[model samples]
Target: MPTPELIPADQQLSWRAITDADLDGWEALLRRMAVEDKPDWIEQRADLEEVLAAKKNNPVLDTILGVDGEGTPRSFGRISANAGSNMVHVFGGVDPAWRRRGIGTAIHEWQVARARKRQADAGIPDGFIRAYVEESNPGHRALLESSGATVVRWFTEMTRDLAEDIPEVDLDPEFEIVAFSDDISESMRLAHNEAFQDHWGSEPRDEESWRFTVTHPEFRPDWSLAVIDKSSGEVAAYEISSYDPESKELVGFIEGYTELLGVRRAWRGRRLAPALLAEAMRRFKADGMEHAGLGVDTENPSGALGLYERMGYTPTRRSMAFEKVLS
Candidate 1:
C-alpha cells in the first residue's frame, strides 16, 4: 500500500461525498476542468436538476473528494458500480497546487475500499473493477495504475464538426424517420437493448432502465431522433443527441450520442445507422449547433469506428478501459 505523504496537522484533509449543497463547487470544478481541457464536444448538461435527482437515488454512486484541514473541498472524484454488479468504476481530479503529493493515489485507495464495502454490504461476490482513463491526461492514468489498475482496452472519442455539413439521406421509401416521443419509451428501450446486445459489457435494458435514462438531466428529447419500419411502425434505428446551452457560453456543443443505433438482425446491412446519424447531424446543426461529438470503440465488432471516421469524426482523445478481477 502506498502511504500518502503526510499533510501536517494544519493541512491534513479528509474526503467527503458530494451533497446537494455542493452543487456550486461541483459545477465550478467541472467548468474549470472544461476550461483547462476542452474535452469532447459531446459532454453536455441539459437538465442538471433531473440528473441530481436521479443521482440521489443511485445506491452505487459516491462522489468522493478530499477536504482540507479547514474543511474546504480540494478535489472531486466519483466511484460508480453498474447496477447489480461488483464492477466499480472510479475517476477523480485533485486541485492543481495540491497534486503530485500522492493525494490522488490515496483517494483511489479510498474508492476501491469503498467499493469493497459496498459489495460486502450487498452480499455480492468479489469480481472485477473497471475504469476509463483518458490518454490526454496521463496523470490520472498514472494514479489509477499506481493503484493496481491495468489498461485492458482502448476506445476513441470521435467528433464531427457539424459545420462540415454531412450530406442528407433519402430515407428508404419503406422506412420512417421520426422523433422518439415519450410514449415510445418502450420502443426506445427495446431498440436499445437489441442494438447493444452484442456490445462489450452490454446487458439488457428494461423499462426501469429507460425510465432512468430519458429522464437524466442531460437527456433532451427534442434532440433525439429515431427511425422506424414504415410497414410495422416498429423502431428500427435511433440516435440520441443533446446540447447543453449552459456549458461553454450560450452557443453550446451539440452531441450526436448514438445511444442505440441499430437495425434488428432481420434488417441489418441496410445502411440504416449511417443514415440515421447523418439525419441526426443535420437536425442538430439546424438547431444552431457548432459541433457534434460521439464516442466509439476502435475495435467494435460492428465497425462503428470506421463509420464515424467516414462521417468526418476524428479521434481527439484516446481512452483505455482498465479492469481488475477481485480475488
Candidate 2:
C-alpha cells in the first residue's frame, strides 16, 4: 500500500500510525472528544488498551492518529477486516476543537484507502466498507451521506431503570438460570451462533473472537446469566453483561450493560428471552445498579424492539450503520 497522505507541510498537524507509547495520549484525546461530542458518554483508558491489544493480534489492521506539533492526537481512525470476510469496518473521530479543518474527512479517506489495500491483498472482489454514525452527530451523518454512503441498518440503545418495578417473567418449568462458567463456553458460543443465524449481517464468531469476548477485562461473569434446559441439560438462552465503571463515574449513573442476549431457535417464543432479561435486570438491581442497558437492531426478526419495550426498556439513543462500496 502506498503511504497515506499527511497534513500539509505548512500545517502544524501530521498523521502517523498509533503506537504503544501513544496510549496515554490516545486516551486523553478520546476523553476530550467525548466531552465535546458526547458529554453524557465516558471514554475509558482500559477499554482503549484492550482494543489496541486485540488489534496487535490481527495482521491486517490499521489505526491512524492525526497529531499536532505538540504530539497530541487530534483525530483517530481505524480500518479492520475479519479474516475471510469481504467487508471492512471503518471508524473515525476528530476532536471537536479540530472540526471544520477537514481532519475527519482526511482520516476517513486514509481508512478507506487502507481497507481497499487490505481487500486487494486478500483477493476480495467488490469489497464493502461499513461505518456507524450516531443520530445526534449531524456532522458525521452529513459527511457519510454526502460521501455516497447509505444507511443499511439501525440500532437503538435501550435502558431500563432497575429502581422501578419489574414484572415477573416465568421460564418454563424445565429451564433454570445458572452462573456462567468456562465449562459451558463452547456450548454458549454454538448456541449464540445458531440463535442469530437469521439476523442481518450475522456471522459466526471465530475462536479468537469468542475467547477475547469471554476473557475481556470488563466482562462481568457474575452478571452474565445463562438458562439451561433441565431435560437435555443444554444451553437455552444467555445474557452476557459488562460493567462500565468509567461510564458510571462520568454519567453519574451505575448501569449494567447486556452486551449479548440470545435464545436458541427452538427456545424462541417460549418466554425464555423475557425470563433471561428479567433475571439480568434482577441481578443488576440486586447489585445496586441504577439501570440496565442493551442495544437492539430495530429490524430484529425476533421482535426484539417490542419485547424490550414491554420489558420497560426505553430507547435512549439511535445509531445508523452505513455502507459504501469499495471496488
Candidate 3:
C-alpha cells in the first residue's frame, strides 16, 4: 500500500510517525481538543500510553502526528484493525487553534486511505472504516460527511447524580452479586460476549483486548460488580466500573464511569441489569462519587436507553459513529 501524504505541500505543518516520546504533546493536544469539543470525555496520559502500547498497534505504521513550524504537535490520527475483523477503526483530533487550515481534512484523508489499505491487505471483501465524533461538533461531522461517511449510529452519554434517590432493585434468590475479581474475570468476559452478540456493531473481544480493558489503569475492581447464578455457577451479569481522575479534575466532580454493562441472554428477563446498576450506584455513592456515568447506544435492541432512564440516568451528551464502506 502506498503511504498517503499526511500533510499537503502547501500546508505549513510537517508530519511524522508518532512514538512513545510524543505522548506528552499528543496528550496535551487531545486534552485541549476535548475541552473545546467534548469536555465530558478527556483522554489522559495513561490512556494515550495504552494506545501506544497496544499489542496489535504498530505506532510507526498505524499512527501519524502533524507538527507546526515550531515543532509543536497540532494534530494526529491513528487506525486499528482487529485480526479477522472487517472493520477498521479510525480516531484523531486537531487542535482548536489550528482549525480551518486543512489539517483535520488531510489527516482524515490519510486515515481513510490507511484503513482501506489495511482491509485490502487482510483480504476483507465487505469491510468499512468507522470513526466517532460528538454531535455538537459540526465541523468534525462535516469533515466526515464530506469524506463519504454517514452517521451509522448514535450513542448517548448518560449520568445519574449520586445525591438523588437510588433505586432498590430486587434480584432472584438464586443469584448472588459479587465484587469483580481475577478469579471471575474470564467468566465475565464470556458473559459479555454472549450478552452483546445480538447488539448492532458489537464484536467479540479476544482475550488480549479483554485483558487490556479489565486491567486498564483506571479500572476499579472494588467498584465493579458481577452477578453469579448460584445454581449454575455462571456469570449472569456484570458492571465494570472505572474512575477517570482527569475527567473528574476537568469537571470538578467525582464521577464513576460504568465502562461496560451486560446481562447474558439467558439472564435477560431476571432484572439483573438494573440490580447490578443500582448496586453500582450505591457503591459509587459510598465512595463519595458525585455522579455515575455510562454510554449507551440510543437504539440498543434491548431498550438500554429506557432502562437507564428508568434508573435515573439522563442524557448529558450525544455522539455519532460515522462509517465509510471500503471498496
Best by the lDDT measure: 3
* Cα lDDT for residue 263, candidate 3: 91
Clashes of each: 1, 0, 0
TM-score winner: 3
Task: Write one digit per residue (lDDT tens) for candidate 3, span 272-315.
Answer: 99998999999989988999999999989788999999999988
Model 3 lDDT-worst window of ten: 1-10
RMSD of each: 3.9, 2.2, 1.7
Off by over 4 Å in 2: 1-10, 39-43, 55-61, 249-252
Model 2 lDDT-worst window of ten: 1-10
lDDT of 1 by residue, 190-297 (tens): 887887888887667656557767776666687677788889988887776655545345224545455555666667777887887888777777877667677777
Better of 1 and 2 by TM-score: 2
Better of 1 and 2 by lDDT: 2
* Sort order, TM-score high to low: 3, 2, 1
